[model samples]
Target: MDLEATKNLSASHTIGNYILKSKLGESSFSTVWKAENKITGGEVAAKQVYLSKLNKNLRNCLDCELNFLSSVNHPNIIRLLDVFEINLGMMFTEALLLDMVLRKSIWSSSASIMLEILKQTVIYMLSVSIIFHFCKSEYLQSQDECCVFLVLEFCSGGNLASYLQQHGRVQEKIAKRFTQQMGDGLKILQSHHIIHRDLKPENILLSGKESDVVLKIADFGLSRVLPDNHVETVCGSPFYMAPEVLQFQRYDCKVDMWSVGVILFELLNGYPPFRGRTNFQNIKSSSCLPFSQHILPGLHPDCVDICSRLLSANPVQRLSFDEFYHHKFLRIKGVGKYHGQ
Candidate 1:
């Protein structure tokens, strides 16, 4: 893998039968590109992972993601298309092909408009979680470098991180819409015994079609399935880390709720709930970010309560999926509001 040039393979080249057209995104180990499948005349996203340049043991982050993708199928989850391991020069690199989702402009001038957008995004996440419950593994192809590739749904809408950063702060109604969707997504994952170890706005993606504003949860690099006993890995973002996760204790799906709190806080406050001057400060004090009480006064009372419970210091004390589903925040009773309507 050409470290410098491979940064945005999505824009530069195609993996196999796909014709690369534009760059979608890039991370330290992988790059996502938008392309057209020459065979079917369909659009797809290609994620190029540079495994040879990573740890000699072959960091299985991509593999883990592939494994999860193979096992789970969801409408909100990006679908894996194919895997490519072509000769870069002297060695081979890994790339995952996926469907691309289109992005739309976020309008925050009005609560009603934002509410509609957030509602659609959450609905998309709910679809993904629903599909995850009955997932089946399928073989695409294997890489020579011991890495794997997956094909997923194409969401042209892009990721939530850029959306939040661009919009700064979302209105209360809009934030609640997003929170419901995110919470529903997590509830689905938890129901199926899947844990989105890393739950952040960046990992959440949007759909391309304007009529279908589906928000997908993408990038399972740090995700893991909890065994019957549960997992003890100390992974996830510093800002969204649960207190128990920070303490290096055995944790379960509740960690995702902790992340949900952080995301909700950011949606309302424009920044992470636990922001510090430096990375060290963020990690050191992140576990104790006072739930939305002080930072989110303008938010609805029920919304604040939900965020507080999700951000509880004790994982066990956090709200469960049932409680979250029936929370007052999601229970909009009037016609002007959204809920069962």
Candidate 2:
């Protein structure tokens, strides 16, 4: 019912038809757990959102995530299997009962008795109102205090961030392979007119074994569908965010291309091209993308071209999604013929 209670929840807790086995990850307002279906015995990642903790923007993101994931069936996107909510009223009611029991001794006086009656009456009316509202509306009110769970496909190989940490600066061949897979995923996003405002290595997941990993675009918490192809919301990780977004300018899907460029650069150089203590400093630092001198001369010209074009500070100069997907680096001969482990 509250933050503390939510934190105390652990393995063995059953929600819907799945049993939470362990925590996969968490954020300020949500937690992801590795769960198993009781009926089918299939493993899934259950993302639980605390409805009371969401603000308007976050609620919109939640709606977007649910809507996008539910309608799409792409190999490079996370699959949503089911969604359900568990009401916290029972827990709240139990706590209220305990509080009343503790205060029973103070109700001996006539005045205290009248006060207790009034409190109970108010509680009864509030409970009735909550029940009626829940029945009438599809969206849960903050007062409802329920946990919404999104059961998704579990990627056991972990995210690209961890992979990079384990094996810093992968081979150029590997980087190209990964980029191609990311392009495949982005094509799906582009077709739907969705802007994945938060695109970074940490948000890309690797499924399958190490030798045959499949990259999936994930974490749509900051994503939105843009029919007009532009948005003004300046939200994203600073290191991988596009300069236009950093400068508070309206941007389009090209912003994601900027992030992909950053990822490609990181995969080849072991770090992002820019660094700053703040967004202002970050934008200033991004005027020049620093390709490692030792590695630059060795990289393919096509690779260098794509990386530079995608990281252009001027959105007008940046590569569009179609261009990036069809660039020579991703489509050239022998690009997908990596044999190294």
| All candidates: TM-score | 0.71, 0.83
- What tens digits encode model 2's per-residue C-alpha lDDT throughout 244-325? 8888888888899999989998898888888788988888878654543324546777777898888888889899998999
lDDT of 1 by residue, 1-341 (tens): 33455443334355567777876766666666777887898877766676654552235555556666666566667667676554342222112211111123233566676666656766765664455335422211121222223445567677888888778877777677677767666665665667788889889987756344566777777766667886777777777787777777888878887888788878877887777775567655654555544564445567778877877777778987678778887777522432212
Candidate 1 clashes: the total is: 24
Error of 1 at 103 (Å): 44
lDDT, candidate 1, residue 334? 28
What C-alpha lDDT values do all the predictions have? 0.65, 0.83
TM-score of 2: 0.83
lDDT of 2 at 60: 92
